[model samples]
Target: MTSNDAWWRGAVIYHVYPRSFQDTSGDGIGDLNGITQRLGHIAELGADAVWISPFVRSPMRDFGYDVLDYCDVDPMFGTLEDFHRLLDTAHKRDLKVLMDQVLSHTSSDHPWFLESRASRDNAKADWYVWADPRPDGSPPNNWLSVFGGSAWQWEPRRSQYYLHNFLREQPDLNFHNPSVRAAVLDVCRFWLEMGVDGFRLDVCAFYFHDPELKDNPPNPNRPSGKSFMFNPYSMQRHVNDIGQPENLAFLEELRGLCDAYSAVLLGELHETDAEKLHREYTAPGRLHLAYGYWLLGAEEIGAGDLYGLVRALGHEAHEGWPAWALENHDFMRAPSRLADGEAPMALTAALISMRGAFCFYQGAELGLPEANVPFERLADPYGREFYPAYPGRDGSRTPIPWNADAPHSGFSEVEPWLPIPAEHRALNAEDQGRLAGSVLARMRRFLNWRRTRPELRDGNMDMLDLPEPVFGFVRAREEDRLLCLFNLGDGPVDVDPPQTGFGTPVEGHGLDWASHAGRVRLPRGGGYFGELA
Candidate 1:
């Protein structure tokens, strides 16, 4: 493969939640054209690619997650032509476009489900996860939905129940069926033939289930953190319901199909043991890159945990690569989660400097904290159920604030599906783009400057043994080696450089830095990027 063919390795992908990106139709929702119009914004931010979330035909029961048709765009988002235009525009900007594929499940309203539930036997009857009652008329197992209660919903026509890891409206597909796999692969071909760069496989681990249908063991350590506390779903270890061994073969098959088209595949892994699963899932023939919620859903993120995670990733030399994301549509913004009192810009520098590929969530460049959406306006079903306790993801999924002074914050002529908070408006891209110290400005400057450093791309990353709250690492390849240190603490800290030796400061990375007498001073949330002398 040529250097350009392996574009996903260490690539910076910009995540776009199309529903909240921009509204070209003025229908209170964002569309493909809106994303095309905003491509320049992402390009200016220096991302290598764009991973647009689901915009496929759907009932919107789970807001495009419950895909009804994978082959076509929903009218609300735009026609297939609009997607073609969006893709063309992105490529023209040198941005690779990756479509989000929710192959694990389909909307209950999907034609496949509609037929599968029609009778005990049909052509597509086994296309979804369906099982008979356990004599007492209860669900097949003790599996629970990630969104709320029982993962099964009884279908009276066949006196059976179907599994749904999320909302019941989103029925889990039965990958155990060969024809089902082929159909989904055909869906992938449809898009690749249409010229998409690749796919961001949604809930990739949930593709297969235990054929015997055993009950998942109770989660011994009740989950708690910024992510899983609100739901009962966190109570189980998820043994039989997901992360099955059969998934590896299916992923390899998917990889084969992707390889034929010279496309890349990124998988989202949901597992308690992320580091272990990350290795298994991304190994040689499986996913090109994979990421779990280890960092995104952490109870508390500190330098120690960050150091451990990077080391565990085996950045020294590993076949399977990993991806990083501080925030996405489903989680609270990074500033609200990890910033504490630190500048969001510093977090940006620290993450982008890491060895693996990275995902830059839309609106994060402006350092926007989670918006405070009122309960009266909540739209996410998962969030609505656990409202006051766990605000779901509505806050992070709100519309981007493009212009501070424009009505509706320049997201649309009509009010957006989700409101743009005043706080976000204050940090709008138009205004932040003009400020030198703003997170947006710093992110752009650093990203562009980092682009010139070849070692950062294919370098061997070694985690530096530094003091707590002052994480350090080195990226080296051949003759070039760069020393990167980040102050993840609250106040300024003066610490000795890594005993191996801190190099001469390399300027132009756009951070206020100081180094002298082999000791470096980093202000709150500031970082240092230097060339190893």
Candidate 2:
């Protein structure tokens, strides 16, 4: 499965939010050219691919997710030619490029929506999900947006309400319409023709809706077991609103297109039974990889949580491939939220050790925590609506600091579209790159080392039921059986090897571990990679 066509199977995909990666344009916003300049960083870090967040033409309502033109690059992110240069540069460094495809919805300003809403008799009238208001003039059904209130937005022109799972400005496309499906595929073809390696499908589970427009049932159990509390989205089970079986056929159609170019499809599954959905979608000719809120939505992740993750998505060969991301553009950073503001290295070690591909968000290597973006500086629609309770995703989306002392930390000549965090300044690449044990250096060293281990790359996994504060797994392939462990708590943890006979430490894996008596001892933020007999 390690063929040229299947490189994503065990790939390490570094996620780059184009708006915050770098800014060569000096417009205070990162552009394609900026990403080109930073390609070397990802290359040197030894990532197999780069999953770029959406940079398409948009109104910036949801940053770049509300695409206005699927085939064009937003001027804020540079022209189409700029993307070609970035793609070429990345390939030159042996790094694959996966562009984000936001096929579920488009900005209300999109021409398709414009033409569809004009008169009701237009050729594209059915291109978007439109339903008539009930006798009481309420929504067609009881559906709530993850952002806030009702999922339905009234449109005066057609005397109908359109379904918008997100912001009213972003209307959901009618995937039941074959024309819409064909057009979305055309969007994929345009990019594939432009030579991208693959696509990371944004809000992928949302592509299809229940044709019957049924109401979703209320969730029996409300949100629990995390510092982050409840919202209306947490109250519903989302049975009919999403996870429709029709989505599988469309995915097959997408897979066939991707197979033509040997491109991969990585879908973003909503956390409504996401693990179960992940298995179904990745069965045969479906998404090459998928991820959900798994552990990302939590304010913090403990040793037990990590253990539960392994149980839910086992390391067995029959299970679907997963693209794990502890931190992303959507929520709090790992160091700030994964534990009590420590264990960055341990968290990363566990992530890379997992059985399938994973996405490492930018700034993670630098150990950047979630910046305190006040309500005044918030930009995310979800955060803005649920301000104090949610605090928004802007904290995690702050600019990546390249130079600790440079203005705007080398991200831009001017202040970035979002403010840069002071905590991240000292952890900038230049400073951390020079340090021997900095987060950036340790991550780079470990990642580069991992590329040499076949067992870590493509092996059957066995989740280890180790002692408290020590949670990890073993990956075995032929003659190579490697054990990866991390100390998820503070102080030191000493544990007997799962099977103690011929355990030997692997060198240059960038963890400060030791052996005492017969037990492996790990200090706070410690990790161990060893070979087993």
Candidate 3:
């Protein structure tokens, strides 16, 4: 492969949360074989790559996010051989593979942590952060976990507390230690050498913690935002717990390691100042891409909001390449999150067609609404605690619907790990695959069209001043310029004709445009882009 291909530059990445993707066995849980079986579906979507959530060996405390064995595949997912098979099959289909790498912390069960906690003077004792308790015997600091409690967990055997920004089962690694950094870099190199294309660095900003273990000051304006309301961890400024300035060096070091294998690294930025942090993390030889949760969390999405975000990133993105996503394993589905609960396939197409590279969660292409898991059937620990107040991520993690009539929606012979929403039966892949106007087919057509447009692949975006609810943008290169217009509101709207270099309209693609009037009629919740002549 040519190292400079950079196929991921403007690629559409399909995200596969392995546990929920497909189960080849009757185990009710998905695995690598299941993913291999589904490769055809992903490839058919015109996606250039697939980003699988973490599948490394783990104790399942955080569903594989808390990594145990960095170099081996989890039994729950599959063996190493199965993974190699997956890579072979995916590469044969021309789809790049990007695995999730959670380096911020490790499961307490990891050998490194086990040895670290065995004694204070052991060979790897300092591999993890270990601190004595305060004189008052409370937590060393006021830092809170994202799961809603103290971030510090006590280790009775060591007689000291270890830092865990998330669950107690996940202990923060001491990246300040050169030995630990070298070990992690070796782990990364192991996978890159195995022919993987890239990595999605999980919680990239939380790589290092405050060396002094100082108490974080309270945020004066914490209660007004999503971070504060969703979890108490947002109440503090978090300066002492994570996102330290020293992280830049680690990023560069990681970039260097990736450079050796020509692998790309996309960082998952999870902080209030994520955009600014993304710029620094991806500047020059740092992260290849950094994605923030700004759009993923927007309670409502519209033409104005979409244009505004693109414009802001356009002006401030700098050397940092932007990666956008409207749905992922963590948040609610966009179709349901949107105010009207109306299927917004056209709007989704428009959003993805914008300048940045994007990732789409498994069911997003089907316009699958969020499955409402009853309180009694809730499997997510976070949702169980939050209850009616805040449902957990499981709502968006239900199994993919393949057959509308098959028992368990054809996902498995046995019951799926998650309940397939009854309403999803009618919208299964089998049903939608046959319908041209269905969300699934629309996505297929859109992706196919997108692949042929060089301007969309690596081009600059310019927002046009169109009417409200209509997001108009121009994607251009030295040789080609394409106009993309979208109506993101209810009811029909018409606008004057647009000036273009091309004359013939690209028919048979769900688009009807008269070059004379520019008065294109769009149905409610429907969208299509016309090629300019």
Candidate 4:
């Protein structure tokens, strides 16, 4: 696998949120040194790579998402020397390192943004998205930021409004500006030269906005049942604000740059028609893989829903590849969101069996549910702005519990940036590592088993048409086939045998099924895997 050029195809990549992973400096914040020390856990867990969230220099307003410097590591995380050492150590463990690249935006304090906002005639004045006020001194268009309120922020120095899809401090970069594109590409080159295996592009779709600055029409599907419905941002069609066709050309240019170093590109696309966008963004000479908010933001986890999403994406992404993640930094944990009795371990098994590369968020293997954070302890700006309605992402970004008895669960010497959940203390990694049938143990077993099975790793997947509560799929690679069946419901489900013959059951940890006279009964949170004849 290390020798393969397309190692990311069907690979399992672990996402390490630096702030929650570990804190070696005793400053109540996780840093590069902590991640370097924990690379062994990821390697032993059978992950091919690790995708680290932003640790670049930032103002901490939006955490590391608001970058002030692209080439330097934040002092909070470590020095540039520390990052080089971390990268070297990770590679020694046979783990590829992927850094988070927030190319679309930069902090208001960033030199580029400061210079751009200083005066209208400055050399970098056009570096960021800026426009004059409308006739009534209002915003140029009806673009709303994801964090709430208007996307345009008033810059008194230039008497112009700058576009900020997220926090006001994080202004969107103007990719239409050739110099800005070159500067961003140079940032990529600097990290590549420093030995980053790849990058996880943040807000990939918001890179290029409509050149004409036309107003976005109101969303016809008002009161859409999706999350963040309380905010007006969801009520707009966003046709003019994002997902511009010009983004494809820029992505191709970015892809060409990455190809020079043999690095992979994974994009995080946000759009209503994500499947269509994923197809266009990942076509040849662009992103190697693109994952959208379909699974991450989905409220329903039924068999039909999972099957439809995977099938639709498979059909839409012609020559491109897809990556799947049940949970990430932005979403709540699977156990908290899933139905009662549907074990997080079961969901982990189901995710690994899917026909694409997998990204497992940190602490997910511990069966960690969403934590309860007091209003006073909230740190997420998004949550603060939409309080009561949306408590923000702080609950999901709590520190990882390493020891059950240690103060702050061995995350920090002092209190952490976010409160550690009492429930997670009982499910710490130290204790779970020694217990069989634990979520962590199950994840280790399944990931190790998945590595040996070519069908599950990079083979063709065919969804089985089983009855409700029973979702089954078959992964095949030429002469070999592995059949996977999962029970998404809480109670037991009796399922008829598939038309295709099933071979002897293959052991996958404790996942088992009872077959009697062509009828199989699966217990709650149960899964079965067998060789297909």
Candidate 5:
């Protein structure tokens, strides 16, 4: 492949939350063999790559994000040999592998963290972020954990407070320390040497903290809706808590490591300024691409919102490539959040066909809704703490539905770690393997269709200024031009073309372009495309 064939650029990545992707071991949780078994399905869907959530050795405190061993695979997932098999199978199928690398923190059970926390002046004492508590016997500052409460955890042995932007079991690593950054880079090198194509850096923005340990000021107006909307943490502007400038230098260092092997890094920026930070982080010589939480939010999808997001990044930076995603391990599926369960196929078609590289979570292609788990079945600690209110991420992390007729949707012979929704049984891969009109079939069709259009693969977007809820954009590269339109609302929308120079419906969804009286009628939650003469 040539430099222009930088596969990460404009390539669709399928995010397989490993624990939910497949369970070939029949162990109730997804594992490496399970992923190997599903590679064909991913390749068939037209995805050029796969981003598997952390399969590294973990205590499962934060469900694999809290890494216990960077160089080894957890037994729950499988051995390192199993991962090699998955990687080999994926590459054999011409698909790249982008694995998760959680840099911000590590599980308390990790050897490094354990050694660091063992004593005040141990060999790895400064490896993690540790600070002296205030004289008042309180946490060092007002910084809050994303999981909830103060970001500091008191360690009695050291008689100090340690910073943890997430669960207390997951302590934030001090990237400000050069040695710590070097060790993390070594971890990256370990995987890249193993032929891993790239990385999805978890909490890419939350790597550093204020040395002064200042307080985060309160946000005068907090955003509402979904889980965190009601939480007080939303009320405070998380300035000192995360998105520190010290992170950029470390990112540059990591980029240097990745560049040595031509490995791509998609930094996952989970912050208030995610889009802005995404632009800053992905600028040349920094990150290959940057994705944030905007697409995962519960905001209603609209033509205007989608167009605005693309335009925002377009205006924000010129050189940095943008990567977009609608669903992932942490968020509910798009169909469930959009309330467009009525026409999810059309919605998925519109989403994947947009102007940038997009990601589809496991089970998303099947149009799976968020499975509601009762309090007794909940496994996430965050959910347990805020029960009956903000249920945790387990709802979206259930097992993949493979066979409709098999018990537990054929995810496993044993009971799944989380309950599989009965509705998902009808939408399994086996049910759609040979049929049209199924969401799985539609995903395969749209992804394949999307790859054939070079204009879409690598082009600039010219958003059409049409009526409300009608998303319109012209994907243009060199001489090729394709007008893509979408009806993101629940009513029919009419698009009066500037002129009838549309030669034909180029991408071929079998729509009648001759009847397009220069005025195209789009059904509720539907989309269409046309090629200019």
Candidate 6:
């Protein structure tokens, strides 16, 4: 599809965490060259595009999230020429590229922040959020950082407090400043000119905070059993600290800039009222799509829960598109998060069969579970602070196993930044690619199968009311309709066919379903797909 077709719509985008994808430079850390070398693997997986995590210049404090330079690549990843080669090679392979744009905050070492923190009278002084201390010499408000502790950091030079929604090294940018907005837009322009297809806006909701710096109210019902359960940041409703009204206007400006290049914009949103924010942020001239952690952060996955998520999004996301992801660099792997046996396989089918765009995380096709990283080997600050309880993201950020017998699982010639899990070696792409019924093979088949069926891609999905453990939906595009039924449980279950005309069962990627007397028998972790009569 051409860019004019808005290819992001109903696209299957693979997420690549550069540090773990592959390491060609022998630095034990994956880089742009590694990713470029692996583009063939992604193309072979049948993904339309790749959403690469941050590879910009950084101090590695928060990995690449704390960007020191937006326009340049870090030496760790490679040089600017390497990035250009990557972009060129990916496009030649018919794959679009989406870079991670950390517009919310920047490393304290960034030149902009350095100049801004120098003095209040400097040209870039107001580029970051700065506030005076309260009369008691405490923080201006009750804002809390997502990484734990106070959001406000004292700067002795200005004798003022600056806001940092994450680590103290990553200070929040002041979107209230028109110049800051223009500068960020210019950063986007630089990448667009360099041939990036689009960007995945990091912490898009945290762009503009409340102008008054008001205190956030406490949340009466804090969610339990989540990766962030121990985080005090979850205790508050976060009304004023994020999801500000000014963010919409700023997004419109960014959209205008992107529209000039026909580039897509995807937002990473976290809001108390996520559905509402998704609707507002993607309405009309805003972000092309917005996705929250409704599925990613769930401790349990149930049919009702999955149905409710889609139903809610269908209702709230009017005039806007939705993007769904089962696993990413930030969350636990789907196999470990979901049930054992065939449940992970079923969930993968369900994720790809959904109505909207899909973001398939790297190594997820191999059905890789969360790796068990020892406390001594942990490199994630978030996990270190809440160790044993949360275990941080290191478990999910381990290197991708390419070859089972190669040193470091073929990720690097030397030691990797994070140890490759032994379990992953058994599920390496090299081995799985040869197995007929492996998750990787199944994923390739399913994704390629999805491409031929318009009903599964850009079709209207209607949720079917089925019994427990069975979630059914019909994807229809004009006269073509496909019935999709999935059993989320481990035990075999029986489900009745829809009252509508039912055609013969369509061939699927090893998913078995037998129908007799209008009753369909679905094996555990099995699903059925057929054309509507």
* Most accurate candidate by lDDT: 6
Residue-by-residue lDDT tens digits, candidate 5, 1-533: 11344777678999998887778777889899999988999999889899999999888988898888999999999999999998999999999999899988999998888899999899999988899988999987888888888888999989998988889999998877788888888999999999999999888888888778789898875765574574677888877878888878888988888888889998888647667787778877888888877768655766677777776676222557777787887776666666555434555566566655777788877878888888899998878877777888888888888998787888888898999888877788998878887777767877887788877766766766777776677777777778877777777777677443444666455222224556777776556788875
Per-prediction TM-score, please?
Answer: 0.97, 0.97, 0.94, 0.97, 0.95, 0.97
Off by over 4 Å in 2: 225-230, 500-502
Residue pairs with backbone overlap in model 5: none
Q: Per-residue lDDT of 460-519 in model 1, one digit per residue for the tens?
A: 787888887888889887888899888877778887858657677888888766876768
Candidate 4's C-alpha runs over 4 A off are 1-3, 222-226, 315-318, 341-343
Q: What TM-score does model 6 achieve against the real structure?
A: 0.97
Tens digits of per-residue lDDT, candidate 4, 1-533, equal 22367788788999999998999999999999999998888887889899999999999999899999999999999999999999999989988899999999999999998899999999998999999999999999888999998999998999999999999999999999999999999999999998899999998899999988999888786533335576888788878878999999999999999999999999998856688888788788999878887767665677888888877777332457788888898876767765563344555678777877889899888888888899999999988998888888888899999988889998999999999988989999999989987888878887888888877767778878887778888888889888888888777887777877666688855675688777777887788888977
Q: Which digits, one per residue and each the tens of the lDDT, describe model 6 over residues 42-159?
A: 9998899999999999998999999999989999999999999999999999899999999999999999999999999999999999999999999999999988899999999999
lDDT of 3 by residue, 1-533 (tens): 11246676678889999988888878998999999999999999889899999998998877898899999999988899999999999999999999899988999999999999988999999999888888988888787888878888888889999988778889989999999899989889999989999899998898788888888888776633332376776678777777889999999989988888878898888755676786688788898877888777766777778776665555232446778888999888887776767646657667667766788899988888889988877777777767677888898999998987778888887988889988887789988999988888878988887787777767766667777777777777675667777777777677565554332345544533333354666666555465553
Ranking by lDDT: 6, 1, 2, 4, 3, 5
Q: Give the CA lDDT, 0 to 100, for residue 210 in model 1.
A: 97
Native-to-model Cα distance after best TM-score fit, residue 484 in candidate 2, in Å: 2.0
- Model 5 alpha-carbon drift over 4 Å, by segment: 1-5, 315-317, 340-343, 499-503, 510-514
> What TM-score should be assigned to candidate 5?
0.95
Candidate 2 per-residue lDDT, tens place, 1-533, comes to 36688778789999999999999888998999999999999999889999999998998999988899998999999999898899899999999999999999999999999999897999999999999999999999999887788999998998899999989999999999999999999999999999999999988889888999988898886656342364677789888888899999999999999999999999898888887888888878999899888778775666788788767765588777888887889877777775476545776688788788979899888888789998888888888888787778898899999997789999999989899978788789998988888888889999998888887777888887777788778888888888888887777888786763326889998887898897888888788878888
Every candidate's lDDT: 0.86, 0.86, 0.80, 0.85, 0.79, 0.87
Off by over 4 Å in 1: 339-343
> What's the true lDDT of residue 209 in model 2?
88
The weakest ten consecutive residues by lDDT in model 1 span 338-347
* TM-score of model number 3: 0.94
